[model samples]
Target chain A: DAGITQSPRHKVTETGTPVTLRCHQTENHRYMYWYRQDPGHGLRLIHYSYGVKDTDKGEVSDGYSVSRSKTEDFLLTLESATSSQTSVYFCAISDLAGGPDTQYFGPGTRLTVL
Target chain B: AQTVTQSQPEMSVQEAETVTLSCTYDTSENNYYLFWYKQPPSRQMILVIRQEAYKQQNATENRFSVNFQKAAKSFSLKISDSQLGDTAMYFCAFMKHGNYGGSQGNLIFGKGTKLSVKP
Candidate 1:
C-alpha cells in the first residue's frame, strides 16, 4: 500500500453530465498518474502530474482533464461524460528517489454512464 | 512508440506446478525498464518484478523470476510452485530511460494474460 486513496469508488451518471474523480496520497510523491483500464486495451495513461502545478498529456488524454494544486492531491475531471468513458480509473504515485521509478497504485474507481 | 505484447490471452496451471508467461516488446532505445504487474480479482495492480535493460543478469523476486533476452526482445515471467493466490491477470509494461522531468517514466502496458491456478 502506498498510502493512496481514491474517492467515489463507484459512480453512475447519465451522459453529458460532469464527473470528477479524486486521488489523494500521503507519501508526498513527486509524480502522480491517472490511467483507464478497459477490456482488450489494458491500462492506458490518461494524464499525469510531476509537481504541484505541472502536468502533461498521456497517450489517451482526450475527453479528460486533470489538475494538481498540492502535492498530495490530483484530480481528474470528465468535462462531459460519455458511454465510451465508462471504465475503471486508477491513480498511481512514484517518488523517483534516485532509484527505480516503481509506481504504487490506488484502489481504483469504477464509473458507468447511461 | 514502444509496444508490449503478451501472446497468451489465457493459461492454466495446477498448484505446485511451474508456469511461464510470455511477453515481447519493441523498442529502438537501448536502455529501458520492463515490469510485470499482477491484478487479482480485487483489481488492485501489484508489481511482481522488474528488470533494467542495463543489467545483464535476470531479476527475481521470491518465486517470480524473469528471463530477459535483450537481443530477442523478449521478457518472460516464470512462477515456481504456483499457488492459488497466483491466479490473476498479468500485464507486461515498458518504460524508457530518461530524466525525471521527461515523459520517459510513463509506462506502456500490454493487454494482459489471464492465469488460472487450478486446484
Candidate 2:
C-alpha cells in the first residue's frame, strides 16, 4: 500500500469505449502485474512484466494490452470496454529478482462499462 | 493443472475467539510455496503468512498461524486470539517452482474465505 498506487480508483464508461488503468510503484520492484477480480472467480491475471519493456500475457489477457517502458510504471489498456469487463483491477509488484518475493497490491480500480 | 480451493465462503467468529479457514490445492509439483493473503475493506491485499513446501514447520505470525499438510495438499489458516480487526477476506495462494533458476511470476489463488469477527 505504501509503495503502490493505482489511478482512477472508480470509473464508469460506456461500452465500445477504450479505457486505460495505470499502476505506479515507488519500490522499483522488477515484477509488475495486472489482475482482475470478479464475483465468483478468483483473481485472474491479465498481464505482467518482468522488466522494463519486457511483458507477457497472463491467464485473462484476451482484451487487454500492457506496456512497461519504465521500471516504476505499468499500464493496462482495454481495447473496447464491455459490461463483462466491469470488475476490480489490481496492480501488484514484487522484487522477484531478489527471489521468493511477496506481492504488494495497490488500492485497486473499479471499472464499470455499461 | 494447479488449482487452489477454499471451501468456506463466509465465516463468523466472536471477538477474541479463534477460527480456521480451510484450503486445498491440486498440484503435482513438490517444490512450491503456499501463502495466505488478507484483503481488508480498504481493498489492500496483505500477506498474512507463508509456508515453504519443503518445510515441515508451520508458520506463525503472532495471532495468525497456518497448518500446512504437504502430503495432504492442505494449507489452512488458524487465527488465534482473533480481534475485530481480523475480519477480512482470506485467500490461499499457490506458487509453482520455476525452472532455469528463475521466478515464474504467477500465483494461483482460491475464491477466498470471508471472515467476520463480531463483538
Candidate 3:
C-alpha cells in the first residue's frame, strides 16, 4: 500500500547517545507501531500509537520512548543507545476505522550502537 | 500470556519444490488471528497471509497456504512450487482480538524459520 517508510535505512551511533528513528506513513493509518527484530528473538513490539497524541508501550519499551504528534508520523527515541539495542527496527500500520486490520510493515532500519 | 514457537530454526528447499514450516502458538483466547510474515534479505516484513480463527477454511495466497489447526493451536505454512524469492526468514504471529480489531492487542511473534531455497 506504500503506507509506511522508515528513515535512515541504516544507522550507526555511539553508546550513551540519544537517537530518534522516524516512521512516516502516507496512507494516514491511525494505528502505527515500532518493533525490533533480533536473532533468536524474532520481532518484539517497542511501542504503538492508536491515534494522534495517543500512544502506549509494548513488551520491549524499556529503553525506548515514542511520540505520535501527528497521525502520519511515529517517532521512536532511544534515550541512551546501547549495544543491546542494536537490531533491525520495523514500523507497521493498521487501519483504525474498523474491520479486520491487517498490519503493513516498512522496510526497516538497521541500527548499530558502537 | 500468548507465545508463538517455531522449533525449526532453519530449513532448506530446492527450487520448484515444496516445503512446510511449522509454527505452534499458546493462547487462552478462542477468538484471534494468525499471520505469516516473510522477511527477505532486504529486511522488509511482508504480510504473506492471515487467517481468522472464526473461519474454518485456511488462508491461501497463490502457492503459499496454511494448515491452521485451531484445536491444537498449530499454524503451519505450506509453500507449493517454491520459488527462489521465497528464501527468507518466515515468522508466525498471533493476535488476540482486543477492544476493536486488536486496537488494544499486539502481534505476538515466534522466533522464526530461516528457509533456504536452493536453485
Q: Please report the candidate that would top TM-score against the real structure.
A: 1
- Compute the TM-score of each model's chain A versus the native chain A and list the values: 0.98, 0.95, 0.95
Tens-place lDDT digits, model 1, residues B11-38: 9999999999999999999999999999
Interface RMSD of each: 1.3, 3.0, 2.1
DockQ rank order: 1, 3, 2
- Name the candidate, 1 or 3, with the larger lDDT value: 1
lDDT of 3 by residue, A20-93 (tens): 99999998887888999988999999898888988888998998999989989999999999999999999998
DockQ of 2: 0.51
Per candidate, chain B TM-score? 0.98, 0.95, 0.96
Instruction: Please state the i-RMS of candidate 2.
Output: 3.0
Question: In candidate 3, residue A51 scores what lDDT?
Answer: 86
lDDT against the true structure, per candidate, is 0.94, 0.89, 0.90
User: What is the C-alpha local distance difference test score of candidate 3?
Assistant: 0.90
The DockQ scores of all candidates, in the order shown, are 0.73, 0.51, 0.65
Worst 10 residues of 2 chain B by lDDT: B96-105
Docking class of 1: medium
The better-scoring model by lDDT among 1 and 2 is: 1
